[model samples]
Target: MAGTSQARDGRMALSFILEKNGAPLTGTSGSLAIGEMGFIISKASSTSAFGDIPVGCFFIASASTTLKDGDSIQKVKPYFLGFATSKSLSQSKNVVDVTMDYDAATNNVSDGVVSSSGSISGSAITETLNMESGINILQSRFTSIISIDGSTIEYKEAQTTEKDILMLGWNFRDCKVGEFLDIDIVPALFSNLSKDASYGSSQTFNVDYTGNFSDENNFVGGHYIVKNVEGLLPSIARPQAAS
Candidate 1:
């Protein structure tokens, strides 16, 4: 594998590990971006989801467009993919490691946002992304007797800070049916992962778990109400969906 290939694939492959229908769908969030040009949907580069991004760097991932009502989704690689928001979108200078599966002909747009124009030069304002329904459990006990299925954990001696529970291959142990795991280790917020991303055409997009949960409002022993139910994007999944 090429040097850049591994890095790009590694970064993006994880981006698409969404729990689809309660199953981890190993896909990629190509990239979505909107700018002076127009709305664009991301095209996956490789099955490899590796991308060199900041710790909290994230862009939106969508199989389809949200803000643009009629914008038809372009299937670049069938996987959601995109670059980080580290810099502005430029056709010549800044485009890097971006993979393409769809072309101008294959790419389609429908029921888009609206026919409008902007007078401000270089002043691009991104639109807001919408999320499905979800809730947060505050106080709960996550006890897991993971069989490990008789497997070995990799990281045991690594330095794990107190803020983060340092257990290799057992993070899932802390999670249960009804508990919402915050991506960020701040304890009661979204994940450190990117909830929203910008891609192909400067179009705004988000990471959402469209998959359904195992049961509705089904409270388990480990899950407690962390905060009120708020409509956020997908990382906030009902893991019960996977069970």
Candidate 2:
């Protein structure tokens, strides 16, 4: 029961916790409940698991649509996983309103504006009364929550200092191979997305996002829990590997 051989069957559990703006979420009685979070775990590519893990580090692999406790290497050594999918982010500014009480004779093109009676390039600009001079900028950002039905269900307004909430966690059992559990915390924004439709085929929606590691206290970016099945003294998750 010494050396690497003892770790051959070290099948411990793994859990990933989520925090928003530096505060952990509620209802987490140790780990986030299933269905409350969305995740995809798949086999780790040989290239994805090398060298020193970094802060804000994440891996991308084919999405895993199943969650079963099976006794096989395929079930144990999954590498890339995340919480959210079909995500979208957008920004817009408000339009300004003004009084349309301008005198037709006095209002001219010299004011960077064309009057209702004026024509630019020999074309009458209809609906001139509703034209706007400029936009009323907004300091808050709007986020739309889209449903699977492709409907813009609701929206959330967040300040520059605020962010949307996402929580992802897992509890591994009989977790062998990597021998330890790790979590990657990425503060991301979905940049691009697409949807494909084909005959007799499943519709696939893809989402892309980019973000960096959090520099928060206590969390140290992401967290990892080391296994101690043999009841080692003072056993605890070690400090994250050097950045």
TM-score per prediction, in order, is: 0.16, 0.28
Off by over 4 Å in 2: 1-143, 146-179, 215-220, 223-225, 228-243
Q: Please, what are the lDDT tens digits per residue for candidate 2 over residues 114-189?
A: 1111000111111111221000001121232222324434332433343212212222333333344333333433
Best by lDDT: 2
* TM-score of candidate 2 on Cα atoms, chains taken together: 0.28
> Listing every candidate in turn, what is its Cα RMSD in Å to the true structure after a full C-alpha superposition?
23.5, 24.2
Ten-residue stretch with the least lDDT total in model 1: 133-142
Cα shift from native, residue 216, model 1 (Å): 38
Model 2 gets an lDDT of: 0.26
